[model samples]
Target: MPRIDRRSFLTSGLAAAAIWRPLGSARAENFRTDPFSLGVGSGSPKADSVVLWTRLILDDASAATSADPFAPVPKQVAGPIDVEWMVAEDEAFSKPVRSGLYRAVPEFAHSLHVEVKGLQPGRWYFYRFRSGNAQSPIGRTRTAPEGVDGFRFAFASCQQYEQGFYSAYGDMAKKDLDLVVHLGDYIYERTYGAGLVRRHGAGVPSMLYEFRDRYALYKSDPELQAAHAAFPWLAAWDDHEVTNNYATDRAPDAPNPAEFLARRRAAYQAWFEHMPVHPDLAAGFDALRIFGHHRFGSLLGLTLLDTRQYRSPQLETSASDDRPERTMLGPAQEEWLARTLGASQAKWNIIAQQTLLSERDTRAGPATGYNLDGWDGYRAARSRLLDAVQISKAANPIVIGGDLHAFYAADVKRDFSDEKAAPIATEFVGGSITSDSPSEASLAAALAENPHLRFASDKHGYAIMRLNDRSAEVDFIGVADRKQRNSPASVFQSFAVSDGIAGVNRL
Candidate 1:
């Protein structure tokens, strides 16, 4: 067996041996038993435990094929894989916290996900896995704090695999954040734009048939992999993860309803495979992964939303009447969010979502029509979410987003129509990892037009958010340029969302 010698590889051998138990009593030679594995990971952190994951890449891992190529067709197993996981306080493993074994079965694509529990909160720990005599690489993770004292987190989104470079990830990785919030559009299905302005390798998998292939292509990116290995991530997806501008029962330019639904299920399954997500919560056919809240003790409660799964189709006529029945997060999820926000006891309530919650009607170009695909298209739903924010009066409601490929800060209001509408929340929009740079001239024009927009930038990068008892500062770090393969980044703009005020002022 050969090892890739890359920093990401786990181990050169598998530890502990188990008797061979071939499928249906098949011979051991037929099944895969690759000793040199790809490696391991951890995610979905609770105060006491976290989920550790890994995939046993077989020597003859099946190649992409016509009908669901990534699907693992059963081959006779060489033997049962003895998998062991360990969590320790230090990288040297002097003080081990937990150690255990799990069987690596072919049914799960030879991957292992162990939810390790019984640990102290607000502490950093190192973890890894082992099989037979082989051991995996050491990964660092942290447990959430129990109360609000001081905390720092970075939020990002819109990482198109083939756009240009992952300078954004590199920038975010250096910030030393406690956790990362990926709002949505983690990967784009459609080759996205085209030409130089926007171009990916190929269209992403719309169905399960190509989900694994797409994820493999994405995971292969060194920057993305580095960022993942560097910290624990809380992620969600937007329309591009499955299809462009996709809404429930509707796909961009997609005609057939049944075929589109099948594609959605496939994409969702693939997303689960590649991401550090839990299996129990994966989206199934007709079932949507919508709104959910994560409570970080009494410090912060982060709410992740799925706007694409239940949104009403963007209106063609664009009338106020279209607002009555339309929604971004269907009535049920909307209610859940309201109750969750109103019920939250945390000092900071963060909404991690796909698009700008602020009214972005003043975007630079021709007032040609708003991206009906975004909140601008579902005015009523946006209003509903904002109304909840007002009613709940969350300690400090902050909406973080990443879809438009630009950084923006706006004071969310009860009414976009009322020039004097009371402020309900604060919004911080992040730019993309390697997407097109919206024209600067347009941004300047839009800035001049929209009074609520305190800050806006067309640069490509991510935001570093630090929250303390006093204020939450957001640094709009911008990269040198994404056209090059390796570009360094710097802070272009910075703003702070005051602790008690619903406003963002330049820092």
Candidate 2:
């Protein structure tokens, strides 16, 4: 094998070069067509390791495209099969740094999650999986760096399959980015909307196989596959991953606790099967906690939260649920966050979670209203996080979230009722990938009622951030049109937050 330059692996052609590759002449098994059509992905980056993932298309059960996303999906079980995977210093697989054989099993839908470790920190690596003569797409991933002068990443969420196309992800695939953070609502459980560009059929997922079929339908998209293959991602779930408006063991329509828990269990199992999280995460399906912290050297600390799993039930009015005992992060997650914040010495601290963090008054005129489904319903819980930041003196705290189907920029205040209070941190909520947003009339009223919310948009897209030692710059990349596939996207707005600033300023 010849020496390969490490930098050459990260050039502009990174995504294109690996876009097409014939199967190697190693024929261990034969298939009628490409079995790697669903594509490959990686996540959970560490200093010496990162997780690589791929699901084999062993049968034609999930290959057919139906008119509805929820139409009954075919199912078959066959796995405990051998899969060969390698992480190379170059895209050519010439300088193999780590390689192994992973056993794909039926328990996890034949999905492979290999946490390859002992890797060089902050370096780009190419990976792929092979079964017999079939080769998966070449995916690019990187281990967390020990240090950095600058870095760029994007955060997005809420891609409703039937609502629109995945052009946002397609646009992201062409950009240079180290990480991608998906802030939940990966798959909508039910179909409910108007003027939808597509259809999810006429059903909602509930059972394990139903959920698996739903995932197969979404993952089959080529644009989504390309984005997954381009960069490492940190993903979490929200209400839709299970059902609409479901809280910790509670659902508005689910009158029976036992039945609800069973549905949630299946949802959790399916989420674990489809996501590229740690293998051990599967152990906590019943406990309803799926959150963790990651670091990119001294530059940044990221805490991915699970707001839907262990949270209090929904509140219709913000003031109705401000009880001192109402919790959002739950006690354990809150404790972990506090401890993590206290110990973090990074210049930038980020809370990547779901929904809006700052208060959003949905009413107009001299009246106070709040979206209790958010921080408003659990003011005390929000206070706990803020208190932890203040007590720990966490540096440059910033919060980015989704689920609102709109973009929002706000300064989270120590006290929202008091306009004179100082902001404790800055918050940015990126637009939904394809989900619909509130009416223009609703957004206008929201802006008028809440002066703290600097900006909000109903357009669909993602948010890109470039961070350096001195500041973090963000751009709202909006899709020009989502009613059609292959639509164009561009940055319509930009904002910046200086190192010591506690608020976002329009750039």
Candidate 3:
């Protein structure tokens, strides 16, 4: 755990308190008459406490006044100037554990992230947010475990808003999951082109101009909102948040530095504003620290990494010697992860990331190589990551990834060079929410040649993981169809990793 800078936090708290006051009797009366339009959310939970979030959607920003927000005004105003949140031990708000007032700034898209601390561990809690007359639908969340037996959580990635419906989320939300791990590419940056798999509406933003608009468009979706309200989410972003295939300091597939820093700042700001991240970490362009570990008691330790921030350029050259000095998790983050995994007391260590780590020399078959933007281009760094897991000898360090728009389960080997390099880890890769799959007969034939790859599917769906003391079971859930919102879901595949196993086994 990171050391708490009490002095700095206190100083910041004082500064915030100076401008913001607690919601009292008078303020509560002023905010009691609106509809629960936007819904509720929770995230960044510790063993004892968790963050509860809500937003007060206004008819318009200016109508919410000292008087009546709903009164017939010539123009609309931001509703519920102040929002209050409460977390309780019971679903009925019978015993209040933590409560507070948060300013629902229109600048922040009328949203608030309130992190409540110092509660009991391993407990389920119900929370809600209110703005004037309108109360958001109540939400449920859980805290981290103080000890471990075994735990379960689902992992997913590459959700393009235009490409498909969010039926996968709808299904996962209903599952008995401890939490949801969103690896990256939660939303796409591209607008609709002709005959695209998923198509975005007009006015979708790409550059800094469309950042706010893009977020609003996405948040309007009921499925996404419901999923947010359903469970605590741990998320990171890939290139689509800003631009497809964007690297740390470069534009899409471009070598020039360009205005990458400015773009990154904008994208980060938009992400923080829309997500349920704590205020302390909401400094947006000021700081970047998403990589962290989550411990479920002594059972499992989950490390969520940011792959785009510090990675080197994806090499386009075919020669092995021409690979760039690339890094998926950067030097510092990689070191931190290795140390964290090595020191973990948990039974399982899971690395949640944005892309696949398995080696696929696509050249041997009808294909050339894996996407340069994925782990294939960063082979050396990926090798080192696997080596870290191997060296740490952590019990069943399962790796979950999403990016290739396909489901893949593989044995993580120390070296692709040796046929018998001991399997160090198991990887489960989920497909896209609604993206197109590669359609090559040669590639279809290539699957038969790959021995290490246990399973691969180019279908659209999500993965559900159930953890127990003896093993972790995962189900690859397939969507009925990607084009329809009311699509059904079915289990397409299942795999498990035992306590002592280094690779996945089919069920």
Which structure among the candidates has the greatest lDDT? 2
Return the candidate ranking by TM-score, descending. 2, 3, 1
RMSD of each candidate? 5.5, 5.9, 7.3
Residue 419 local lDDT, model 2:
78
Off by over 4 Å in 1: 1-40, 59-82, 104-108, 132-134, 194-204, 282-285, 288-290, 363-368
lDDT of 3 by residue, 377-445 (tens): 887788788778878877778888888888889888777646677677888998887666554453454
Q: Which pairs clash in model 2? A: 68-200, 68-201, 69-200, 69-201
Model 2, residue 286: C-alpha shift (Å): 1.5
Candidate 3: which stretches are off by over 4 Å? 1-36, 61-71, 74-80, 192-199, 203-209, 253-258, 320-324, 364-368, 440-446
Q: Write the per-residue lDDT of candidate 2 for residues 1-507, one digit (tens) a residue.
A: 122111112223344335423334433445435667678889998989999988876664543454568754543336366777888888777777887777787888888889898999998999987665466768888888898888788999999999999999999988888899999999999886888888776488778889888888889888888888888999999999989888898998689988989889998988888888888776766764568898998898999998988888887655563677889988899999999999999999998999888887798877777777788787889888889888988899999999999998988887877777777898999999999888878888888788788888899999998889999889999999888899999999999989987887998
Better of 1 and 2 by lDDT: 2
- The TM-score that candidate 3 achieves is 0.87
lDDT of 2 at 268: 91
TM-score of 2: 0.91
